[model samples]
Target: MGMSAGYELSRRGLKTLLIDAFDPPHPNGSHHGEPRLIRHAYSGGPAYVKLALRADELWRELEEATGEKLLERAGVLNIADPDVYSYAGRFQDAADHGVRIEDLDADQIRFRWPDVRIPDHYRAMFEPNAGYLYSEKCVAAYKKLALHSGASLLPNTFVKRIQAERSFVSVFTNTEHFIANHVILSAGAWFKTLEPFVRLPIRSVRKVVGWFEPSVSSFEAGTFPGFTFASSLGSYYGFPDIAGAGVKIGRHETGEEWQPGEDLVPFGAYSEDEGDLRKALEAYMPDAAGKLLKSAVCKYEHTPDDHFIIDTHPEHSNVILAGGFSGHGFKFASVVGEILANQIELGHWGRDVGLFSAARFSPISP
Candidate 1:
C-alpha cells in the first residue's frame, strides 16, 4: 500500500524515501494474500463508494503506467438475507451513489452462477465492475516504478524511533537516521509505537485467511466471482480459484487480539477459528468449502470504526498519519497513494474526506 504512495511521490518529482520493516511483495505483511475484493458500492458508507470510484480510475492509471494486469474484471457477489447489511445498507449505497447494481434472488443466482447454492431466503447484489486486485504484484509494480523514479527504498530496516519538531521530523532506524522536512507514517501494524509522538487511536489485531478446495470444479476464475456472504455470525468473503490456489476465504470480523512483533503467525489449520468457519462454509457453500487446504495469518491495524484515518497530525502538520485502515484499505491503495502525496505536499486533500477524519470519533480539532 505504501509502495503506491512512494511511487506517486517519486513520480511527482519529490525526493521520496520509502522504508519498510519487511521487503516489498514479501509475505510478512498484509499484502501477502493474492487477491482482495474491490467493490464500488460499499456497505461501509456512501462516501467510501465515492472514494472507491476514484480509486478504480487510479488503479487503471497505475496499470497503464506499469504495463501489468493488476486488476481482474470478475465482478463481485454480495450475498445476504433481505434484512442483512448487504441487502439493506450496501444496496442503499449503490442507489445513493448511482452505481450499477443487480439484485439477484436465490433462483437467479443459481441460474447465473450455477455453482453457488444459496438458501431460498438469501439474495445477492452483483456489481459487474467489482473484482480482485492482484495485491503483491501491484506493490511490486509500484516499487519498481518508485525505484526507477529515483526514490530511496530501505527494506528490512526497522524504524526504532521518531522525533517530530516544529520545523522538521527526525526518523531513526535500527542502523540509520533520516531527517526530512515532512514525514508520512504509513506503517501498517507497527503504527502504535510511534503514537507518543503522533497519537492516533489505532489497534493492531490478528487476522487470518483460509484457502479451501471446492467439491466441484466450478471455482474457476470465470465460473465464480469473488463473493461475501452476510450471515448472523459475520461477513465471510472469498475469492475464486485464481492460479489454482483453490479459494481464499476470510472473515471481516476481528480475530484474536495481538500486539505487533509479538503475536504468532499461523499457517497450518487449527481448531479454534477454522472449526466455526468450516461449519459456516458447509452450511452455506458446501461445494466450495468442502476441503480446507491451509490458512495464513496476518495483522490489521484497526480504529474503533472500520474507516481509514488519512489526515495529517492535528498538532504537527509536517507529520501525516495514515494507519488504521482496518483491512479494506488495499483496494484504495492506488488512489490513496495520491491522497497521501497531496496531503504531505499541500497539507490538505483536494478530495472529500469528511468521513475518514480522526476527529470524527472525538471532539478534536484538525
Candidate 2:
C-alpha cells in the first residue's frame, strides 16, 4: 500500500517519501509469496468489486508503463457447496456487478477441469479475466516507478515513534527525524506500534502457505486455474504451478496470533501447514497432492470483522491509516493506494468508503 501510494502521490507532484522497515520485495510482510490471486467475484461485499475493477486497470497500466509482465490472466475458480457457503449469492453479486463469470455445476467443473474432484452438491464460479499478480514483481515495479517519479524511498529504516500534531506529523527513525504534512501508516503488522496516536482494531496473525509438486501435469498454470474452495473442512485457496515453482496452497482463516518485532516461524518450517494443505488437495484435487516442496509463514493483519480499515486517524486527520487487509487485500493494493492518495489530496475518495472507516469501530456514546 505504501509503495503504490507513494508512486501515485509522487506522480501527482506531491513530494513523497516511501519508508519501509525492510528492503523492497522482502518476504517479511504480507506482499510476499510469488503470486496472489485476483478475482472480481468478491465474497466480502459488492463495494470491493469497484475497487477490484479499478485495481485491474491500474495493474495493466503499470505493466504498460514499465513494460513488465505483472498480472497473469489465468482465470480463477471459486468452488463451494451451495448449502455450506453462499456461492450462489457471490455468483449473483458478481453478475450483478457486470463481472464476466461462468456458472458451473459440479459435473461441469469436473468436465472442465478433470484434475479437480468436486462433489455432486458443489457449485463453481469461473472468472475468466481473474488471475494472479506477481507480488514481488509488482512491488519492485511500483518502487522503481515511485523513484522515477521523484519519490525518496527509505528502506531498512526502523521508525521508533510518530508524533501527529495539528499542523504536521513527526516520524522519528533510528537515524533521523522526518516531518511531513501528512503521514500514512501503512506499516502492515507494526501498525499497532504507533500507540495512542493511532489506535486500530487490527490483529496480526501468522499464516502458513505451502508449495506442492503436482503428480499430474493438469495443474500447470496454462491449463489449471487458481481456486478458492469453501468447504466444511475450511476455506482454502491455491495457485497453479507457475514457472515450475509448484502449486501453492494455503488455508485462509487458520493462523496463530502474531506480534511484530517478535521471532517468527522460520520459512520452510511449516510442516503442519503443509499437512493441512495436503488434506485439502487430497479431498479436492487428489492428483495435485504429490509432494510438499516448501512452505513459508507470513502475517495477516486482520480486522475485527474481517473487513479492511482505510480511514484517517480519528484524532489526527492528516495521518491516514491503511491496514487490516485480512489476508485478501494484495490484489486491491493499486486501488487502495489511489484511495489513500485521494484521501490526502481531496479529503474524500468519492466512493462509499464509509464501510471501511475507523468510525465503525469507534465507541458508542450513550
lDDT of 1: 0.81
**Candidate 2 regions off by >4 Å?**
267-271, 363-366
lDDT of 2 by residue, 146-230 (tens): 9999999999988888887899999999889999999998988887666766778889988888888998898999999999999
CA deviation > 4 Å runs, candidate 1:
95-98, 268-270, 361-366
Q: What TM-score does prediction 2 earn? A: 0.96
Q: Which digits, one per residue and each the tens of the lDDT, describe model 1 over residues 1-366?
A: 588889888988999999888788887667887888899988677778888998999889889997999999899998887666546667777887778899988899988877776679888889988999998889999999999999999999888888878998999997888999888888887776675666667777777787888877778788788898887867888898876788878887857777767856574545656765676677777777766777778877788888888877777788777778888889989888888888777766778877788777653332
- TM-scores, all models, native as reference: 0.94, 0.96
State each model's CA lDDT, in order: 0.81, 0.87
Highest TM-score, which number? 2
